[model samples]
Target: MLTQYHIEMNREALGEHFSERALQIITTANINQDRLAGQFGHDEYHFDNNAIDKGNRYINEQRGYILATLIGAGVSPSVAWSAFGRLLHSAQDFYAHSNYVTLWLDENNASSSALEIDPLTKSILLSPKLHTGKVYFPMDVVYFIKPLRSFALKLLPKDSHGWMNLDSPEQGFKFDYAIRAAVKRTKHEFELLQKLLTPEMLAKFVDK
Candidate 1:
């Protein structure tokens, strides 16, 4: 479940920024910005100029997903949850809706030993360092790597699964690194949301 703190902080930090950014990357394929917008019953956003390609593919793709989540979570004026983005399932609607057993199952390779955080991943560690308080932490990002990938892979048919393991070690490792990075990003995002909440942030509801 997402907290009010999570919702408000995200709405504050990201709400003000996503539209213009989407306008900047509407042409990218596999994103289907128009279809996604229509799914939410909103009009497709427009670009400032087709020539303003200033960033890398990751910026467009990653933020594109984030923008989608924000739009979905904020669909109503009194939307009770903040966005957990890909980290959560669609049925979730509150913070108390935790499934520790599921989380434990996903990250542990069906058992308990954790993934080793390779020290060689120094450059890739930059994203998760955004946790300033106990609100989120460094090792928490390490815990995210296997589970997040497992979560994403869950979307595929079993026959189409294991696609990532087929890649070169470096490519596999890049995917590995990216999932860890996403956890940290979400944690940082939640911490930012904590900064913008009212006491209603404490209310809870059953996950849908």
Candidate 2:
């Protein structure tokens, strides 16, 4: 997803539950992921290129880091937020990069108006065919260059990221669903963290 939406959606999801300082910490960490060198080529970073297992592994690794940091002595809120933000980035990207929304719409025969509803069922999310767009090169490269983007689209495969992304409203009608799902997932992540961390650990982590 786009950087602005990443920040906006995460804030919407976590604002009421976390202090402003804590929110900023995670937001900064989230944005930094995009700034990493060769980030676009890293399938697991954005859950792109049909890298489901890699993305899942990346998320679990971050979650493990957050758990260890929080549960052990000398808890570091910054370290925990950094890992949390990285995990959230991958989770959010699943909606934008994958066919999950399309699968939901197909199964429900739903339109964009139903975008606010939760799109994931156990079956839909875990479908064997559930897959994300492949990151085709040169075409993918040109697509990022505004002047060449339209031209690139003609060459990009229908199953490629350039064609399938729901990063913004301009991409397609499913942008709303992507935003909603990402926000919901962000909150869900926080809830899971709440469950895992002791009340004291949670308080410190969130600056409560």
Candidate 3:
């Protein structure tokens, strides 16, 4: 149930609730990535699907999972506005810092991103405050997720947290191994999400 018009959600409130919600979804999905991947194309839970387009196949599933999790958690339909806001803020920043990513998108019109830190994932890794630029064989969508792709594209590549370029096989395998780690890790921009939730959204999501 949505609150009356008198109710309001400030950014801080939204961030907290959103963080909680994101964590909830990430956790639930991590437990079931293999089953979910079967729905997509029989490929188990991989962060990147070589068979499908990068931003299209992978991020779409992540977004779908996030949305369904919210609904299952009883998020009021009204919360979508706040979620979109978070997506825009997080994805744009990641892209701006990844220069090689931008050039790849420009060259090929599409790109593939893997959880493993191959040349592909390394090119788009959102670098820590540094000025290095990166480029790939052909410009690709994974390179420019935000302006070029759907808002959900911001939250995907859920494999291998910390940096997009995960250094080892173990690290890559565990990329977003659990949702709480993904949502509550305190490093990624999901940190900026708002947590303010109405009594209704709160009651609904209390399970996690």
* Pairs in steric clash, model 2: none
Judged by TM-score, which candidate is best?
Answer: 2
lDDT agreement with native, every candidate:
0.28, 0.85, 0.32
lDDT of 2 by residue, 1-208 (tens): 8899999988898888878888898888887777857276678988888899999899989999988888788766889888888899989999999988888777775854544547447888789879898888778878989899999999998999999999889986788888888888888888888898888888878887
Using TM-score as the measure, what is the rank order of every candidate, best first?
2, 3, 1
Error of 1 at 181 (Å): 0.7
Model 1 per-residue lDDT tens digits across residues 20-92:
3331232122123224342232111111111112112323444445444344544431222322232221111
lDDT of 2 at 203: 85
| 1-208 per-residue lDDT for model 3 (tens digits) | 0111001212232344445654444333333332433325432133222222332244444445435646564555334433333332222222222233334443443433322123234433433431222222123224344354333334344321223422123333323222212222222333222244345544444322
Q: In candidate 3, where is summed lDDT lowest over 10 consecutive residues?
A: 1-10
Q: Candidate 1 or 2, higher lDDT?
A: 2
lDDT at 116, model 2: 59
Q: Give the root-mean-square deviation of each candidate in angstroms.
A: 16.6, 1.6, 15.7
